[model samples]
Target: MNDMRMSPNLALNQLVAQRRAAGESLVHLGFGESRLPPFAPLMERLAAGATRNAYGPVAGSPEVRAAVAGYFGRRNIPTGADQIVVAPGSKPLLMALGLVVPGDVILPRPAWNTYAPQARLAGKHPIAVAIPEECGGVPDPAALRESITAARVLGRDPRILILTLPDNPTGTLAPPALIRELCAIAEEEGLLIVSDEIYRDVVHDPATEFLSPAEVAPASTVVVTGLSKSLALGGWRIGAARFPHGPWGEWIRSGVVSVASEVWSTLAAPMQSVAEYAFGEPEDIRERLRASARLHGAVAREVHRITIAAGARCRPPTGAFYVYPDFEPVRAELGKYEVTDSPTLARRMLDLGIVVLAGHLLGDEGEALRFKCATSMLYGETVEEQQLALDAPDPLALAHVRSLLERVEEGFMRLVP
Candidate 1:
């Protein structure tokens, strides 16, 4: 606890907030939050349940769990209410899983910053493997096998693997074939898989292919998701997880519930009401997700173009609202401005009134000139404008949004050229 500071994403959000509060005009692309207003129905549910004040169940109310189960069922995964657990947020649920799950953790090189910390808190060593050239969430399959072998040879126990669908920082999804290959490796090594699908619904293109490890390695995988990104309900603090069937899955779910009982107690009574309503996937909720995805895609693509135009190589974003751009190709040019590594590169951008999360913060090599740029914050600043962005046929056409994107492009043009 003493050695660990606040999570970099959260810390960056705070720094940006303070800067803005003091009247600094800056473009914030560091935090990975789904910056949208809550849907009215979801908020209504919270207000409707305000009268019901009780701790409810540690694993969440049977009603909400069933709603989450139905959510999975509709997605083609057969789930039972007994296999679901709801908590204040997926963060705690993930922490509980880390605690109950044994041995070391294997993570994609540039994963959510939270995973490595959770592994450390659980007394497990986190082994980092570079992701495949095509995606950011799952590790490169061949590299995964080699890393596992190397860890075992060094007398380490690599027992678990974590994957994010529509990953943060990179905003790209791993294809189904890669998922299957990774699942095979997990099965071969007798490893448990934790699939974080919080951003599953945030895919920019409805036709994009997504495969959950649970689908391929059902017996060995558990899934955790929440309304934070899907419904823009981050502050409401509602999260749910679906465990697999059979004895092994049952045992693991029990452990997480036990931990939840002592920790969060239960997702707040009002939020459970919110979860039950949101997880039911009403048509309105579905449409809101669709609109949000559209807006995110528009902003993210423009950011990618700006990076490319500035001579940085970036993976095209297909989901979520982030783009990981590597400035290594322009390292010599940036060196003229005293930017040599990821940290300095981020600082130089911040100096230009554009804040980005440096790639090194996400577990990449510090010397590499890379950073995570989040486009979610570029949406209109007010709820009215946000609603306009949601309703607009082309959010990029909105003057406020376009102005911000212009701010980013102009900032980059000055620094790079």
Candidate 2:
């Protein structure tokens, strides 16, 4: 445990906080936290249940489980309350999957920073396959078979394949065809799928065809989601998982619940009340999520435009609020400043008042001149300002938001010019 470092995103957030405390002006793009104000009714729900403080079921209260079950059911993945397990956060649920699921894990080369570390901590190897050029969540389908065979030859047992729909780092959603192809690979390889759909609700376009692995291959997929990304409830730590319905699914859920009982005990009672309210998907909560998604999409596209114009190769963010930009196009220009790799690129940007998570931290190759810039944090510095941005017809045009975008543009331009 001592050998494992703090999660890269969290660590970067802390660094940004420390710098800000020392009075530095920094455009913080290092964290993927949804920088929106909390919904009022959810807060009311939290306060309403504050008095009910006793330990609830380890798997979660029945009401919250059923609510989560309904949440999955509405998404076309039919679920039962027995198939759901609510945890403090999806991180713990993911870790539990790592511990109980047998063998090494297969991950996209540059995945969310936590997957590989969690695999290592769970005493399993993480096999990273490069993602398709179009997205960053799933392994490149052409490479999946060969990578699995290679791992086996090296004495590693690869049993689980984890995917992030509308991925972090590079916030592009995998198209339905891509998802079907990957699910086929998982089926052929006899691999269990852990679909991290935490960002499912944050799709930029309402017409975007978002597909979940559970929908394609429900027999072997476990879908994990939380209120953190969608509802600006990161600190609340409310997450739930929907296991496939079968004997194997039951077995896995039992293992996770046993682990939960020993670790977090249960999702906090007050948070369970909040989860019930949020997952119930009331009209007002739905409206809030929709507004937040619009704000995220607008700001992310603006950042994408800035990165491209400044000579970086980036996927236009289609979901979530992150942009993974590769600076190799400007490698020659960056070389003048000794910025040869992701770390140096991030460091140079930091010196110029922009904060981004280096690609290497998210398990990209150390030599790649790439880093992830989270556009979500560009919304505003205060709750009131964030609300105003959310309510604005053109958020990116607003002065407070535009200044942050300009900072990103200026920082990248300095690297290239």
Best by lDDT: 2
In angstroms, give how far residue 232 of model 2 lies from its true place. Answer: 0.6
Task: Report the lDDT tens digits of candidate 2 across residue range 3-95.
Answer: 377887888888988999999999888888999888999999999999987998899989999999998888888889999999999999999
Cα lDDT computed for each candidate against the true fold: 0.90, 0.91
Please give the distance, in angstroms, between residue 281's alpha carbon in candidate 1 and its true position after superposition: 0.8
Which pairs of residues have clashing backbones in candidate 1? none
> Which stretches of model 2 miss by more than 4 angstroms?
none
Error of 1 at 262 (Å): 0.6
Query: What is the number of residue pairs that collide in model 2?
Result: 0
